[model samples]
Target: ITAKGKPQISTMRVIYQPQQGVTIVQWQFEQSIGWLPWEKLGSIMNDKILGPMMEKNLDQLRRLIEAETSSL
Candidate 1:
């Protein structure tokens, strides 16, 4: 998806599976280091921002799912 006249792309795959009556989500993000031979920026982004952001988003997803499940 492109937004604001800017070009961007992500290499991520999300898989959903049910285990023991619960939903399990497996997510993988493929790293990209374009035009730069070094990976320092990618490493820092993953460690400092992307990692925590993903965790927080997953937590929010879980809570929303559980809330709706309980109401069902």
Candidate 2:
């Protein structure tokens, strides 16, 4: 629960798949909002709120992976 007394839940998944000779990485994020009217309304803004942050995080992860593998 948040300080506002609303329940919040989130999940993240990372998937790796090998196709031919290259590996692909994919991720998913999900959040559960409480059953309050305001919460439901606020859910509408979740994508706009979270998209940029998520993209930044993914870019960091990609850079880290590239740096780590460059020597191999």
Candidate 3:
């Protein structure tokens, strides 16, 4: 999914492991920086920039899921 005014692609996947009785959710965001040298260099900091945001989002998702499931 593309966020408003954001030039990036986001993907989410849910995988269930019946044997392990667990589910795994994965999220990824990808942004393309042009082949310019500066852009290529900036790409190296992508994780440092986006990692905390991703973790926060995932934590919120987990809390929401747990709340809903607990109600059921």
For residues 1-72, write the lDDT of model 2, one tens digit per residue. Answer: 667765665555655555654555555555568788977777768777877787888889889988999978
Candidate 2 Cα lDDT to native: 0.70
Per-residue lDDT over 1-72 for candidate 1, one digit per residue giving the tens place of the 0 to 100 score: 223343334444555555645456655454544555445575566668777787788789889989998999
**Model 2: runs farther than 4 Å from truth?**
4-6, 21-28, 34-37
Give the whole-model CA lDDT for all candidates, comma-separated. Answer: 0.61, 0.70, 0.82
How much is 44 displaced in model 2, in angstroms?
2.2
Estimated TM-score for each candidate: 0.59, 0.61, 0.71
- Candidate 3 lDDT over 1-72, as tens digits, reads 223353777789999999998889999978777778976676668877888899999999999999999999
Best prediction by TM-score: 3
Report the Cα RMSD per candidate: 4.5, 2.9, 3.9
Q: Which stretches of candidate 1 lie above 4 Å from their native place?
A: 1-19, 34-37
Per-residue error for 1 in candidate 2, Å, reads 2.6
Model 3 residue pairs with clashes: none
